[model samples]
Target: MVGSENEARITAAEFRGGAGTAAWRVTATGPQAVFRAVSLTQAASLVGPAVEAAERLGILADIDVRPEGVIVCVPDRDFGGISAAAIAFSASVSTAAASLGLEPDPARIQSVGIYVAQHSATDARPFFAAALGYEDLGDGDAVDPLRRGPQLAFNPITGDVPRRGRTHFDVSVPADQAEARVAAALAAGGRLADDSHAPAWWSLASPDNHGVDIAAWSDDVGD
Candidate 1:
């Protein structure tokens, strides 16, 4: 992680987690500071001067800046392909961000993540990937599906969603990378999500079970 002497100390701090520890609250002092996790030896190259700036400004006071272990998210909506869903989310997030005044350039960001699933027989690879010569695998594939897509190029007018069967994989990707992935999905004619991804929520489709949990919608409906 890149930082000034003062910020470097912050970036190097140890983090605690249930599964693993990460470098916590890493700081840098510069105009376009970026704080991301890296091996102890690769700190300087991966961490950049921009992150140092954010640190000098005290942005790390609230969140964990440099963290270990991959954070993953899966879409509540199913796409015909895992890559398509990731791309859809990524593009939509960027459009939303630009409308909000945070104009972050997509190229400088590092490390995007998405989801994979345990596949059984009868599950087909997403059409886009299969067309590109990616083979399917049992249990799962060796590579992540969404990482291969166009970046940051989406069309609001032509956006769509490809229908998915009951069984599939749900993956989470970093917001910026998700934008690039979404561009690809849009190019391939896939649908985007109406709701954002969050940990406390998940969707399960089961014909046998149904419940009316009115409290979930109360906050949005003026209750």
Candidate 2:
């Protein structure tokens, strides 16, 4: 959901991880922040429970939403399949105290995502993506999308890159809470991609070729 549409910005995103239940570092703008979660939650997981509990306060005021695209990254080892992960929601702000079921300070939240892996022939597919946040890049408390930008190209283990250039972010949620997040996005009028719509691994293995495809929320849908 990333492009200049109706004066609104749409951006596609995804995530990656080396192991299960790992602490994920999500870069939003600048000064990257980190979160912990698993990697088994299905791409189609965050569609029910989260939505039932969270609510929208205003237009683009409480969620992260983006367009659909592809994200490619080199793995530590070769595998039979691929899996792409993403967080879907509108470009909005969320209060941890208001949206999440748990009790946290009602601070602004950027539509953030975690990373996923590819193991099976059907793993290299993107579900949806989003980044939730409050202030723009000016505020120190807010994430600087350009500063904490996604790793466009880099080596998996050493994080070494041959050439420095713009690259897509590899962000996805842990498998454990994938469903809950998806449900929240949907309830906010967001949707995740069906596994069936995913493409084959061979179709998207080039290191230089990476992207993330997320569904954006329309005015009516988000409302």
Top candidate (TM-score)? 1
Tens-digit per-residue lDDT, 95-203, candidate 2:
2212322221111212342233322232111221124322232211223333233222211223434333322333333233334444554566544434343221011
lDDT of 1 by residue, 1-223 (tens): 2222332221111111111211111111101112333443222332233234234433321111223311122211111111212222233323333343333332332321123222233323455245554433333342323433321111122223333233222322222244454455445544443224322122322233321100011111110
TM-scores vs. true structure, each candidate: 0.22, 0.21
> How many residue pairs clash in each candidate at the backbone level?
30, 67
What is each predicted model's overall lDDT from 0 to 1?
A: 0.26, 0.24
- TM accuracy, model 1: 0.22
